[model samples]
Target: MKIEQIYTGCLAQGAYYIVSENEAAIIDPLREVKPYLDRLEKDNVTLKYIFETHFHADFVSGHLDLSKKTNAPIVYGPTAQPEFEAIIAEDNQIFEIGNIKIKVLHTPGHTMESTTYLLIDENGVETAIFTGDTLFLGDVGRPDLAQKAGSVTQEDLAGILYESLHNKIMPLDDSITVYPAHGAGSACGKNMQKETVDILGNQKRTNYALNQPDKESFIREVLDGLTAPPKYFGMNVAMNKGGYDSLDTVMDRGLNPISVEDFESFAEETGALILDTRGPADFHKGFIPNAINIGLKGDFAPWVGNLIVDVKHPLLLVADEGTEEEVITRLSRVGFDNVLGYLKGGFEAWKNSTKEIDEIKRISPAEFAEAFNENSKVIDVRKIGEYSAEHIDNAYSRPLDTISDWVSTIDDSEHFFLHCAGGYRSMIAASILNSHGIRNFTEVEGGFNGIKKTEKFPVSDFVCQSKTL
Candidate 1:
């Protein structure tokens, strides 16, 4: 079998392509199907089947488009109970594509429709299994999504997931390799491996959930550890059922260079919030006063949600020359569509205009500890749920998304020392606070772990966050 791992940098999603004999099957395809079609043509093969392990919750799937374009049979579990059309597959169902033997295993932990496909090469030896979100490398898929389209609870699904893992997924051959749909940056599951490839033996020994003493303990631990699925998940499910409306092509739009005088005039008239997408090193050197510095090097969208800006408000991007299209794409992924335009010529244009630039105060962990001990009010800007699980000493929790509502809770009488998991979310949090007429805000240099050694005391006791886990 010819297997290729396809990673979509646009959405940070991944999929698999399996080919045997003269036929090819795609598992968990993205919105754009042309690339898959071209692959088939290039390899001198015909597209036969497209499989969606489950209705995806992140980006839209290309299953429908692949079916529409190729008229190939689309397969999903009979109990998928999806909103769209498909040929319902049953457990233990076997089919031959070229010389490849495909076996469908009904594993309903992540979603009712969730499945894992076992493949045997023409040599009759088991090779790899496509295990969707049902089983990840170190962590299993979060079974906390609402089940049966809208009727089931996360606990209900999690219970079934327990049965599925112990009874079905765990029984596979130790040599069978595993391929999951998403990786590290995916919200689908926390603690995802950096690489998608994992052998069953390796996963069996190292996967925490897999190491539980017994079934009951396994159920409790797996279900209790999940973070809340993102808000956009439901829409993505329906999108896959109906088929994703993928971009035919990414259009590169250019922004003309603007002088500082022009930028100032535009900012005053349009009131577009300036978005900086450069790295921390570049941003800390100099920036437009009051501009938010949530760089695009990391997951920029989720943090966009944490931004206190009103979604109804407009935004102007300060991305470098090649990143204009990317900034727009990532923002749209997170449901932010209010982008006005980009700052032409980037920082160089501003410098050429001779406008004064300001540097945001970035501090090391040691300095942050001394300041935090003496006079600073530590603000953890992660979600309320994350803050509850683990947090720093003397840190007051104001979730990134809802901070504007609780600004008054802070005395504004102390030095504001802020941090998030990494620096990205903190940068975003700092930018939000700065925009809200609050000054004296300093973003922690390394975020939580970067300055972790500076702790004057032990990490604070935590509570079970309500909404997430």
Candidate 2:
């Protein structure tokens, strides 16, 4: 059996393409299915199955599109409550395509209908187990996500997770390799190691969740340090429920070619979101009021998704005319097809037009130090684990994933200052606060590293906060 792990760093997701002899199956599909299909076609393998580890909450999956395009069945665990059409895959249920033997294992930890796939070679030799979210290289999936959505309590799901870990995953051969749907930077797991893969024996010996003193203890530890999943998670889940219509390519968004006067009219009437995709520094220097600052430096799709897109408004992007196609393609990959059009020239055109703009201030380390002591409060938007491990003393912290809640914890009357590991989340978070009329704010340029390098921190060095910044 041959397997390929496709990693999407933007979402920190890992999907699989498993092939043996002449047939293949793809697992935990991203919204775009053509990439997987292209692989199968290029490899001369017939596509046979599309498997979803579970009804994902983080991003939309392409299971429906794959099934529709290839005439392959969408496979889910027997207990899955999927709204769309899918085969109810039962535990130990076996199917074959060419020489590949597919065995389904109903692992109900991450979600009620979570399923893992085990593959056998042409000679009937068991090869590996695709554990999905049930097991990861160093950690296990958080029990909280699917439970609340499915009307299952965390305690109930934790019980299921314990059983899945001990009874199903643990029983696999020591040599059986394990594959998971999520990796580092994903909210699904608390401490996923930075490894591409792992063996059953290795996980059993080293994975903290797997080595718990007892099932109860494991569940407690697993949920304790979790950063809340993104606010868009549930929205994505509902979207993938009925299944999504996939894109062929970047949709040919017609350039309506509005006159400059008409562009301003639409900006006033239709409420087009003008995204200044320049540098954060440039945006902070000057840009449009209500124009969100999503610099091209970070992962474009997710930042755009988190900051801009919704089921609500259409977007008017402003990129260097050179990056127009690049912007469209990235946004399309995330299912944000609401691109009305792009600004003709760039911010320079806007500046020339006397279009109104706003500026976000990037505070210096000394300025931040003064703010840290006197001017304003600091907000750390790093992950929960990262914050708890070590952080700027007495600063308000909630990971970027939990920004919605982060604000709720603080009184809006008091100004909230924002910072992240680097400058990414700080810009995003500050943009959020700035929109809410919290204007007396700024991000410590380069975040903690910037603050550290520019001035001696008032505290000690615990973990490597990166002078490499």
TM-score of each: 0.78, 0.86
Q: Between which residue pairs do clashes occur in model 2?
A: 287-357, 287-358, 288-357, 288-358
lDDT of 1 by residue, 1-469 (tens): 7999898653557788888889998898866577899998899988888888988777667787688888888889748765567778999898688998889989997888899889988988888889889988888888776565567877677778888888887887899989888777677787677777889989999998888887677778887757556655665565566543334322222233445567767777888778888877678678787888878887676556445224435677788778877777666444345566677888878867768787767887878766665344677877666676778755777676665567655555456788887777777666656666666778887887777666563476664322310
**Residues 1-469, candidate 2, lDDT per residue (tens digit)?**
7789999887778899988778888888887677988998898988888888887876778787788788888888778877877888878999786777889988887888888888777888777888778887898887887766457887788889999878877887888878888788676777888886888899989988888898789878887766555556666767767654455433455233344455667776877776667776677777767667677767766777665537335777767667876666566555666677777777777778866777787887777766666444667787655676667766665666555545545555655567887787678777666666667656777787777775554543234332210
For lDDT, the strongest prediction is 1
The predictions' CA RMSDs to the true structure, in order, are 5.0, 4.6
The lDDT values for all models are 0.74, 0.73
Residue pairs with backbone overlap in model 1: none
TM-score (C-alpha) between model 2 and the true structure: 0.86
Residue 384 in candidate 2, Cα distance off native in Å: 4.6
